[model samples]
Target chain A: MSETEALESMVGGEYKYGFTTDVEYEDFPTGINEDIIREISRRKDEPEWVLEFRLEAFEKWKQMEEPDWPNVEYEKPDFENIQYYSSPKKKDGKKAESLDDVDPQILETYEKLGIPLQEQKQLQGIAVDAVFDSESIFTTFKEKLAEAGVIFCSISEAIQDHPEIVKEYLGSVVPKGDNFYAALNSAVFSDGSFVYVPEDTVCPMELSTYFRINNMQSGQFERTLIICEDNSHVSYLEGCTAPQYQDNQLHAAVVELVALEDAEIKYSTIQNWYSGDEKGQGGIFNFVTKRGHCRGDNSKISWTQVETGSAITWKYPSVIMQGDNSVGEFYSVAVTNQRQQADTGTKMIHVGKNTKSTIISKGISAGESNNSYRGLVKISPRADGAQNYSVCDSMLIGQTCGAHTFPYIESANPTAKVEHEASTSRVGEEQIFYLQQRGMDEDDAISLIVNGFAKEVLQELPMEFAVEADKLLGIKLEGSVG
Target chain B: MLEIKDLHVCVEEDPSEEILKGVNLTINKGEIHAIMGPNGSGKSTLSKVVAGHEAYEVTQGDILYNGESILELEADERAHLGIFLAFQYPVEVPGVTNKNLLRQAYNTIAEEQGREELDPLQFEDHAREQLELVDMKEEFLERSVNAGFSGGEKKRNEIFQMAVLQPKLAFLDETDSGLDIDALKIVANGINELSGEDNATVLVTHYQRILDYVQPDHVHVMIDGKIAKSGDKDLAIKLEEKGYDWLSKDASVL
Candidate 1:
């Protein structure tokens, strides 16, 4: 067959994680109101201060409007038709004491996703906080983390168990009124991971969170917060997936991070939410607001993400370099295929003197899809001698796909320097023939070229994730020949 | 070992304009044949067609390897069947190290031949031997496949790949185009060492400079997409001295 025909065949692979599990669950009525926010806070048994925080955020969300600045085009989400909260029905509302007490169906679902529930069989040296629907099912290796004075648990539990820490850092980096989605997430956010690394101590193992949206018509509003004390280091990973549905689902999440003096935090995400059918009829609208604050001198924060799913994705995991000699980095690889549209990038804000930031983004578009990279680099007057470097590259696979880059740089300091480079290229016939002449088939050649194009960002992921991301790109562009 | 009968080929973009019109040639085992031609004489097209390049349509022809028709095979399929082509300007594939590509290509051919595939360690040892044959440094294996290499380095890499694949029918298409004197000798020497009684070589060039290093059993002067004259190695020297005008005029009269 011809190369073009083979590429067209790539649009037919089904989403492997699209099967819904049969689990009995309770969900709130569709719509948002003050009572609903209060009920959610009461269900979690949050303190009065936390309840007041949600109430104030809900008031702001009621006055806010969804922004349309992103380049992606999608139907406006109907807030009234979405279930803001959903959770698996439990016996007498008791939390699971161990893996055995958790629902068998939920455990099976995690197993099918290649996440073993047994601690021995789980990924070695990695603690996981598995969030299903609106609640954390289980958290592994808590004892090991607690031995080092680290706090890792579901945000709901943290609000009740560690209210002082939660109240001090919550909404500190990403305030409740930061953006339209962030405001919504702050009001009725369900469950997400919360981590705290102690001063001068490196976390013994990697911390991870796996989020799954199983209930139909339920919007997943998860809020994640992480704090690193002075001289501490932590690496966190996040992964998400959802079952297929004929109606669109909304996922608006907020992630806030804080790094103290000499602290370093690395956050990585592999978003594989259900991307809908080939016609783009039903899929998740992933609009997320994630940002980190380098609060002390010599602090560092890096965000690395590989986004391969979601019909329409709009997110910018950004950083604020508030401390002198702080470093911020963003590396991303976004792939869109079969009617998917993604507009994602990062924002670097330099506030203190001698701060530095780097941004590298790679976008791959195939099968009539559109991928865009939009980023901003800003240096305040006080940030003298600040430096920023940005590289954005896009690779178009077929004739119908589109790629765009939008970069904004503003520097008020005379010594501040910002560099931006952008390029767009297509997989050409000559590149395919060159590999073919060396005994590689069409699919293999396309995978090789696509991986090579995204190597700069893929290599930034952890070892296991780097391999998984490579295979994910191959599957997403199975037969596509650029 | 290979035969081409009344081959008529044209660019797929404009098939009516034939680039190789009714060409015929043959090469047996243990033989080296060199095709010399001027510009636009279809020398490169002939080699590409033999290697099953998809851009060129074989309108009326059949290519047989070991008495089996290979006109319908793909380029990679032909490579697995012991057909190799040394490109004039090898394409650069960034981010794929030479060692990684060579291991893949070598194992692909090895698996098809019912031979045990080499593991990474074994392949590294095997590839080092081929690197020495091309006078290449061990560091070259760590570099991306031909990316950012000089003209001579690319040529040497092509020969190095040829030495590894060990094809029975090898076509060197303008392999000496951008080589310096030292590089040219190394490439020629590598080709000579790889050639034996069980394999054959076809050298297509516009100059006779490469022929001085590797002797040819037969030299054919290709004019207007056909072998207008065939003789011993002296034919290349004559063409070098008299130019293709004499051969074209002689063929037109005949």
Candidate 2:
């Protein structure tokens, strides 16, 4: 049977990447230690300080305990059973210029996912970095991007080519001691996107990265770093998917952004990782750490994400505004179905005078799924005139599902102003009746209402990715109502 | 075009109490029918039964649209067959845009009938024309579907959608209950313009004023889960002249 037909036979049958690749790699033993860290550093040819940082992070990860605060149930990850690194054998050599030159099996995997792996001469101003398994497969549109003074390449390449830039801001926003998953990501991260926008440059086009989890024996830990200089602007899109498997896969990634004076960074994530089976068994365990920092005056950082897959999701793409007149915004729509659970939100920290932030979150829970919106907005004592507005809404499609919102607001500054509004409601029979009265079928009507409910977040996505995201969430949520 | 024979419905979980008890009604093409009754008298339930609301279980009933039964159809299926219901209370969808939703809904029915789908520009033109027919502001299309619309704006939007969809059997359930004079007339006028010779409408209201704007071919006084009286437009004026108590007293000592 074809991959689509095979996936159609699997539980829920909507995810297209239920097929696995057939490439052999020299896998590391299932374990983590100082030796493993050193081995990864040695394999990647990293600088001495970077290796030292990894060792330190691994030690901290050992000291930290796994977080139990999220409303998710899963087996505790066994550090001793997880192989730290697994890469394609050919990646030890030079990157291929075309898909034909790459491994046939790996190229076919990309083709199945509808991603064009071959580098196009005319890219329409967008640059792409494709990551397969635990390796940076290829970084396309390099010369075109370099001509515009835009640094868009893999993080490993950035460490080799621009060590000073990478070293100065590697873990500044999200430190190695931040959380368990983040520390693990720091210790064994393989490869992810690294972008830099020079001063006064608009960066010309969007930068995209497609992440595929191909190695079934080893979990994938990827790290991404983006920095926008003064008066510069850039929008980054991150897409992730994994091959289906009977054994649940694990994905832990770290993404950090730094916005300098008068600069702006818009980060969009469309996470369609393989959600487990129809019986809600053997899916991905997605624990991610993403945070952005406004390091200079008048800087802005916005995060928009549409999360619809994964059996369990634990993530909160956060922002810290430390510059005067800085701004932060977060828009997210998380849908959980068929026993999936998500405990995700953001943190907006105001440390500078006159900083502001706006947060809008919509959660849709169906089919016995549990979804929560948990966030914190803290205004420090020095942050005079800090302002914030947060609205969190949840829509429950069935009686068996549950939706919860937890907002933590702490303001030491007397002059700070904070406003928060939250509501939980079900998709009522009357609402469906109203839409049907307008000549819509049950599926179309539900899609329309849901698209509207997540409009705030969907509008935040790039125009090219919005339609696909809508269709992805809509079709997955069809027939999900009680 | 619309007929309900011995309709019996109960709240899905509560099988003991029937909301609509053996109700029978018929509305022909090009005709206007009004069903007015006191609260809990099954006026709204009758409208919901014909539109296939999932919350109301049809224990024994046959709802026919153009001589074809729609009891087994989904809500949207009934709608595509030209059934429309202007809800007493509209729903609020925060993130979806009014224009995007309306266009999608209109195109779905059109496509099901083998009609061409409107391009974005063409959709925008249709949307503006319909909004103008309801006297709604042009900016309403850009807002999230009924997210922050006022009471008047919400009712106007219902009429606006009705005008755009142009169903064959329209059900205006309490369309004028909460509207001010201007909003009421605007809603009635939009409904009046959308009604045609080949299409039918059932106006369920509590007052005779809305009927003055959109005169009905027949007025139905629904009392105690059944039609107590049915007559021409003048009967609505009679009900307006005398309170609903008159009807109940004429039937029995209430």
Q: Pick the candidate with the highest TM-score.
A: 1
Candidate 1 at residue A471, lDDT? 61
- Candidate 1 C-alpha lDDT tens digits along A441-478: 77777888888788888898876567546667877887
Chain A TM-score vs. truth, each candidate: 0.96, 0.95
DockQ, per model, reads 0.68, 0.68
Interface RMSD of each: 1.0, 1.6
Tens digits of per-residue lDDT, candidate 2, A30-65, equal 788889899999988999989988988999999999
B-chain TM-score for every candidate:
0.98, 0.96
The model with the greatest lDDT is 1
TM-score of 1: 0.96
* Candidate 1, residue A203: how far the Cα is off, in Å: 0.9
Question: What residue runs in model 1 are displaced by over 4 Å at the alpha carbon?
Answer: A1-14
